[model samples]
Target: MYALYYTPGAASLVVHWLLLELDQPHELRAVDIAAREHKDASYLALNPNGVVPTLLVDGQPRYEAAALAMLLADRHGDGAFAPAPADPQRAEYLQWMFNLTATLQAPLRLWWYPGDLQCDDEAVRRGARARFEAACERLDAHLGAHGPYLLGERLSAADFYLTMLMRWSRNLPRPAHDRPHLGALARRMKARPSFAELYRREGLEEWA
Candidate 1:
């Protein structure tokens, strides 16, 4: 059985969503960050980074949300959540997944936990917000051009990853919903049973 360690609304959400989407039987171990449980020895052995979303694949530890998503797609999705190697859309699909992590998700990390940047200045906050919105603007344009989903008509695991990010962006000056196309995509995705189940299980009420 698959086992996952996570906190609500953390990067783990997308992985949890994927596990449900694939109907994969799994176990959830909530690492209470509030109590510093993640930093404790047992959790660290499974995930050295002491972060959420650590997956035990056949009892072997796997971390990184994006990597776990790709792993799931590769193992079980069979060109559904991801385009296969020979598929025409594979290159673009790969691009969006990497870009989603680097360009979009990375900045939101700093935005949410600015203390990681080692400065509490308002200027730093402005810079992080600008980076976040800029990434969203690029995604919004892409969604407008070819989207409601990341891979055009195909809804890949990338779409779920993006949705998870956008949900966290709800408190920003310009949330994902502020962008017309992105907003529409989010609205459509929110209707999915996978997302609904994620929120219910995670107890995340915001941006649901």
Candidate 2:
């Protein structure tokens, strides 16, 4: 069984959702970020970064939500939710996974937490928002051309990852779900039973 340390509706949602999607045996250990539990000594031991979603796999701790998602999908050996090493779609899969984490997720994080960029200047925040929207535009175009899934016809961990990020964008100036293609994608993904289960389990509402 896997142990996942998480705070509801955070980046942790993606990894937790992936585990359930795979029907993997796992337990969620809540680390209440609001109460500063994550910064405490005990939780710090599990995740020095003091963030949510610290995953313990085979009794070893790992952090970073996207990396954990990739690891779990790869480790499962089914290659249905994730491509195996030799799969032909592997290249595109890797490309978008890295792109989503690096390009799209980075700007969203910066935009959402402007303090992390060291100044609450509106200009800086606006720039961050602009960057994120541009990234979304690119993603929208890609989906319009080749999606129903990030990898053309088949869904993957990348889509789940995208779902979490898109959920975050609900409060943005031009929210991700407002884009026609992205909106359609979000609607399709939200229809999955796992999505409803995740909402109920995590107590997430509003963005739905």
Candidate 3:
């Protein structure tokens, strides 16, 4: 069984959702970020980064939300949530996964925690917001051209990651969902039964 260290609706949401989607047996360990519990020595031992979504895989601690998502889908999805390595779509699947994490999710960190740079928060937020929106526009166009899902008709772990990122944009000046294609993707993803179970477990209702 896996033990997942998480905060409700944080990066851990994707990991938790995947566990539910795959029907994996697991346990949740809530980290109180506001109380600084994630930074404690005990928690830090499991996750040096003090971030949510640190998963204990086979009793070994592992972190990084995207990595965990890909790992879980590959291991548990039985070819449903990830393409087989020999499949032609494998390359495209990896491409979207990396793009979502590196291109899209990276800017969101700065958008949410601009103070980390010790620069003018507003400047950081503006630049990050612009970068994020540009990525979203490109993704929207890609979906418009070739999607009902990122890899055409198949639902992959990357779509789950994208849906989480899109939800993060709910408060942005121009949310990612404002893009027609992305909005449709989000609606499709959120309509999954696992997503509702995720919300119920995570106690999240705002995005729903």
Candidate 4:
């Protein structure tokens, strides 16, 4: 059986959600971050970076959320998390997923480090916030243009990643859910039964 090394509340949430969506059987091993378990020598051998959400496949480790999502999608089927590579919408789907990881996630990170960016220096923090806010604005605009989901109207992994990031964004100096469309999208995702089940199983109180 596959064993997923994860923390209670981390990017592991995405992998956990994806695994549930795939209906795959796997073991959930929570690495206590508070105890520095992830930094242990044994854990380091499994994941050199000492990060959570490392999937142990056949006893081999596979990391990176985007890669894991794509791997799961491919392993599941053609029309599930991802469409066939030949499909026209595949480009847009992959684009949105990567955008969540690359564009959206960075700003969300800064919310946890406002002063570290030297927020006192208007230029530093302002520039960081601007960069982050711009991404949120672009995401908001994309959601408005696309409507219901990140890709047109079908629910996809992109939505999951976006929803996860938005959950983080809510605590930011600038929250994405402040936008009507973005807020609505998050509400829709949170209301889904599948998401609720995953939350319950993980004992996650709230998603957004």
RMSD of each: 1.1, 1.1, 0.7, 2.5
Residues 1-208 of candidate 4: C-alpha lDDT, one tens digit per residue: 7788887657777888888888888999989988999999998998898877799877789987777777787677557778678988889988888878877776556555566665665565566567778888887887788777888778778887888777876665767888888899889888877688877777778543
Leading candidate by lDDT: 3
- C-alpha displacement of 170 in model 4, angstroms? 1.9
Q: Identify the runs in model 4 with alpha carbons over 4 angstroms from their true place.
A: 113-126
Better of 2 and 4 by lDDT: 2
Q: Give the Å error, residue 35, model 2.
A: 0.5
lDDT tens per residue, model 1, 1-208? 8998989988999999999999899999898899999899998888899898899998799999999998898788666799989999989988988998998788888887778878975666788889888888899998999987888899998998898889888888888778899999889989998888888998988887
How far is 139's C-alpha from truth in model 2 (Å)? 0.4
Clashes of each: 0, 0, 0, 0
Estimated TM-score per prediction? 0.96, 0.96, 0.99, 0.88
The lDDT of model 2 is: 0.88
TM-score, candidate 2, is 0.96
TM-score of candidate 1 to 2 decimals: 0.96
Q: State which candidate has the highest TM-score.
A: 3
lDDT of 4 at 179: 89
